[model samples]
Target: MARSKGQTALNRAQIVETGLRLLNEVGLDGLTLRRVAKELNVQAPALYWHVGNKQELLDEMATAMLREMSGGQGSDPPGSNWQELLAQAGRGLRRALLRYRDGAKVFAGTRLTDTGHAEEQEAHLRRLVAAGFSPDAAARASFIVFVFTEGFVIEQQAVHPMPGERAPGYDVTERAEALGPEFPLAAQAGADLFGDYDARFEEGLSAVIAGIGATLGPRTQS
Candidate 1:
């Protein structure tokens, strides 16, 4: 059906906004152009005018999310040093990912093309370089923090086992029992191996920052 006169034509921003909402509702797998078009009351062809295909739509969705996650809102002030900067970014990334179901799953492998995202990343790297890290080390440290955050969030949001179904892999007790006395330490520790996620993330974030700090050695006079 053709849209009536005075009705708003679908645009890229509206399409992306609708796509993000659908992503949170049905996750990446269920998100499709037809679904978005239906939700927007536009024909599927209308959606193509904005986004070429499903993969292109996903790229836009991922870019929008990365822009938001990359401090586009300026929610917090810049950190004093690279360590503090990295810590803030790590926490921010995890918090942003947690906002949408399967957020990390959507973001992990996609490369962002948005200009805002590039600026945010540049700011982060500049802070690190200014804090005594060589450019190469700064880049590596940034990836380390990002990878750690993504990896941690993936496990944190792992599948929720349905009633009467087998528990997810995080259930250490099941695995420990399966191992029996042959792996005594594993049995004894049980779920303790996983530790508390919040505490573990903070500790791991600290360790990553500290490891990067160690690489700096002494701060050279600028």
Candidate 2:
């Protein structure tokens, strides 16, 4: 497959941007290098110059999403404590993952293509260390918060799927009814479990941060 005539103008950034736009339209399953190439009006072979395969493209897209979340800079505001920094990072990450359809899925397992995230992580870990967490503890604490945020968004997307759209079978009333009268507590819990995502996320994040502080804080160290 020969390169497209305009392939010279194509770059990795443009490919990633186009891939992200198409992701919202067709979703991760539907997105493909060929589809992206078509959107960019370039030959499929042209994309290989920037991304060798679909996974590579997805990795790039994921990295781009993170960059957008951080605004291409360290996100910590001045004077923020470690807990505040972790919470802010969690909230910012959730917002970023919610921006595109299946954004969480896109970001979950892919490797980033650049070092920008490394810089942010280094700063985050350093802050945690300065706050008296051992390096290993800091890494674990940060990872716990990160995974909590990622998992929350994954489930949120599963329930909502798309803006103004609720996936079938998640209706609180119907869910409660299906559980029947025998399971009163489980049925009643459906409403809280399935709805109030924003509040639930904040509550969950707070708990995670608190748990880290309790277990990994300076005072907890032996």
TM-score against native, each model: 0.79, 0.90
Q: lDDT of each structure?
A: 0.75, 0.89
Put down candidate 2 lDDT per residue, 1-222, tens digits, no spaces: 555555658889999999999998898899999999999888798899889999999999999999898784455788888889788889889989999999999999999888877777888899889888899998999889889999998999889877787878899999888999999999999889889899999999999999998887667445
Best-matching candidate per TM-score = 2
Error of 1 at 173 (Å): 4.4
Candidate 1: count of backbone clashes, pairs at least 3 residues apart or interchain:
0
Model 1: lowest-lDDT 10 consecutive positions:
159-168
Give Cα distance to truth, residue 176, candidate 1, Å. 4.1
What's the CA error at residue 220 for candidate 2, in Å? 7.0
